[model samples]
Target: MGFELPDRSVLPRHPVIVGDEPRQSGSGAMFCHLYPANGQPTGEVAGAGAADVDAAVAAARAAQPAWRAMNGDARRDLLLRYAAVLKQHAQELAALETLGNGSPVMMAGYAPMVAAQRFEYYAGWADKLRGQTLSAWNNPAHNYVDYEPYGVVGAVIPWNGPVFAAAMLLAPVLAAGNCVVIKAPELAPYSVMRMGELFLEAGFPPGVVNMLAGGPEVGAAIVGHADVDKVAFIGSGGTARKVLQSAAENLTPCCLELGGKSAVIVFEDADLAQAGQMGLSGAISVSGQGCVNGTRVLVQRSIYDQYLAVMQQIAGHIPVGDPLDPGTVMGPVISEASVQRILGIVGKAREEGARVLTGGQRLDGEYADGFYLPLTIIADVDPASSLSRHEVFGPVLAVTPFDSEEEAIALANGTDYGLGAYIHTRDLRRAHSVANQMQAGMIHVNASGEGMQPFAPFGGMKQSGFGRLGGEQGLLEFLQTRNVWMNLKAPQ
Candidate 1:
């Protein structure tokens, strides 16, 4: 079976891009405008090239000294102000996010809330940024390490969760005192542009945070720009590879959060009803666009049919409509290309002999204009099938059976991606062992989803990309430690 798409009118609304902004996407509505690469906006997108990047970098360099000079309290206060401003504009922000990225308005609302919490979390950390104290190995002396921010960070965000991911990268980077030049993904640049207004209102100096809307050339230029100290990106592994190659030109440090095809495990002893709901929720949440979504479900063979029946029922009930509709549960994908990519994955699944239980066809006529693919459930997926291994980035779920705990572990850990994994079992000891054995950055026991927490580290262990994004560990991602040593006693 394959995925089905809804009719055109089910499409999400798009926000208008403010004047002179360079925009893309077949649907138009001006989602983004290209800014000057050097820090000035050329009337034409082409003219806003290298010189614009240079200008932006120069502006950032000039502003960074003063920005960094602010005491921790001042920085924290500014972030607190920013948080308040974001809260005040939550509705507007949520609407913009939905319109720009085709996410459900409800999920879009979560962005502002999460962003606010992230700000609050990092705000509290600003004044507490500390290094280490240690004894000198070879001398009667004490040594300490001081943490400092790297100047001029280049942030390259993706379209899936534009506002939320940008806020995630921005909060800690800024709170740590680094000036930023963001290259917002072309697909959803409007959301980022709107955010700049909030940052300015919150009193961040101009050039301290700059934004640009363009494609790979722009990202390459920003990454290789001589003045940039580091680069942060969230996107596909293919693009991540290119970004890394580009960043290497200047030896700039990079933080990457790439793609994943996470798995969910269901043992016979587990709760089938709840796990079924969780499986559907894990697969369809964000329309299956999240990196950590459990797209692959490994059910114990004894209950595979029962579990599949429940999942199919739940997936069939998911509402596919306008993202603006308060009652809508799932929305259109960000672009037509995304739809094509998703359908292409389905085609491959069929060729590879997977059984599509429901939603394997497109809903034509009315939904022709909307880029939406129906939630798809595939059963009897061959262990070696591409559908079980790759990220479809759509509302597609693959179910395969496992005969034993070891088999379940093998199936879940087979993917190159190590973002997250899910396990459900009544036996606590078995759950613990499985959790420890699963080859993923995060694991959910008896649960089918993962979420961000301020005190826990989040990142993958394999091809899913590197570095933590939350907790004290995540804060350190944006900081550089400097070691200082002195002899408290007489020098030997």
Candidate 2:
């Protein structure tokens, strides 16, 4: 039933599953979703309301002791086996993601694949969990610390990259010996359920990993649940603020992975071709839905026109069609609301005196139901406009010309966000200086975006979000430190 790509406008005649047991409900039973590939309604996902959250939490609370008692090696084995299961069902999982979210099929598949890799990466860290030692000057004794896990981790994921973000939280939370109750996003629940199936196959104790699916109520319930020790959330800054407020009641430690309006800077001495390619790819990947996307381009005034010409030519050709189509490089913007939001930003940019270089039209031809926005490029956009300072989350790249290194750095750091900033310069001193000046979690030197790697840390400094998600820091976020003091002095 899932293999066939239904038309975007019509609802599919199926239902997405809820639990490990093939307990199914009719379409729209739980979630209000359409096929992401075509922007049509698919089968309804069964919703797990308040009662479901309680049940899942109870299950997790009950199983926590035993699951926590298990050694890290055993957990590692289970995760490795789970990784294998994901690999085996990758095709099925990928198709589900593509259908549930409107991203290109290839792009949708990326989350599941990366999620599996993430699990494997954290699985290796299970046994490597460690603490530290601190010196106590006041007393003649050895002082140290131990890393420990909080009991039940509540994971609230966003629709943009449901599987990956969930895995990003879950992998480390589990590896740190914490049981988790994951609440899938209302907009994209299918992929989360698919992940649950993989976990079940990985042989995690039944209650150790539970999934609750529904809307805001369900997520709120999970985060506020008394038994849940920590909350890991990935969503908008507005939503994240509410989550933080909600979590405050219980003093639950919360990690918020929020939004961004990242910058990509181009200097005259750099490789223009590489800069253009990375700039276009960074802004357009995931249709500009990613939190770390390079939506703002700061080019040196000398080469601004040349860079625009190259960028315009390349942006014009980005494939926008059926996400399932192998040739498609860009897809719909996830929802109609997102499309409207992007359009509003474009209008605001024009009012602020930005020039539309190319692609400012809403595409309705070929795929009528799909919500595809043109690969838009706005030149000479005011740095003060929302398009330059806020996240549009669409295929729109705003370019602003800058003169000298100080202005480039000043403009890049002007926004409230500090997620990611990119710089391209052949001069080593200039690149290093620019990289240091930008106030962001990650700064890409001579590259438009940070290439995917398992080792590097990826997170923002300011409003982009608190806490790291990848690399050693990511794993550490899920872990807590405990000091252990040892005394060699003879008992007197």
The lDDT values for all models are 0.76, 0.78
Assess candidate 2 and give its lDDT. Answer: 0.78
Model 2 alpha-carbon drift over 4 Å, by segment = 1-29, 136-140
User: In model 1, what lDDT does residue 307 have?
Assistant: 90
Mind sharing the TM-score for model 1?
A: 0.89
Worst 10 residues of 1 by lDDT: 34-43
Candidate 2 to truth, TM = 0.93
Model 2, 1-492: lDDT tens digits are: 122464533322222222344234422235667655456676566677677777777777877788778888988988888877877877776666777676677777767778888889988988787777788775578898887778888898888777778778888888888888887677877777767766766667778888766788888888888888888888889888888888988999988888888899999997988899898876578888888888899999999999999998887777777777777788777788877888888887888888999877788767556777878899998888778888888888999999989999999999999988888889999988888888998888877554545556777778888988777898888778777777767778
Per-residue lDDT tens digits of candidate 1, residues 1-492? 112222324222222111122222222112333111111121222213455567667878888898888888998988888888888888877876776667777778888877888888889988888778986886677799998899989888888788778888888898899988887676655567667667776777767787666666677788888899989888889989998888898898999888888889999998888888888875568788888889899999999888988888778788876677677788766666677887888888888888888776654554556676788898899878889988888888999999999999999999899999888889999999999998888888877654566667788879999987888888899999898888777745
Quote the lDDT for 158 in model 1.
86
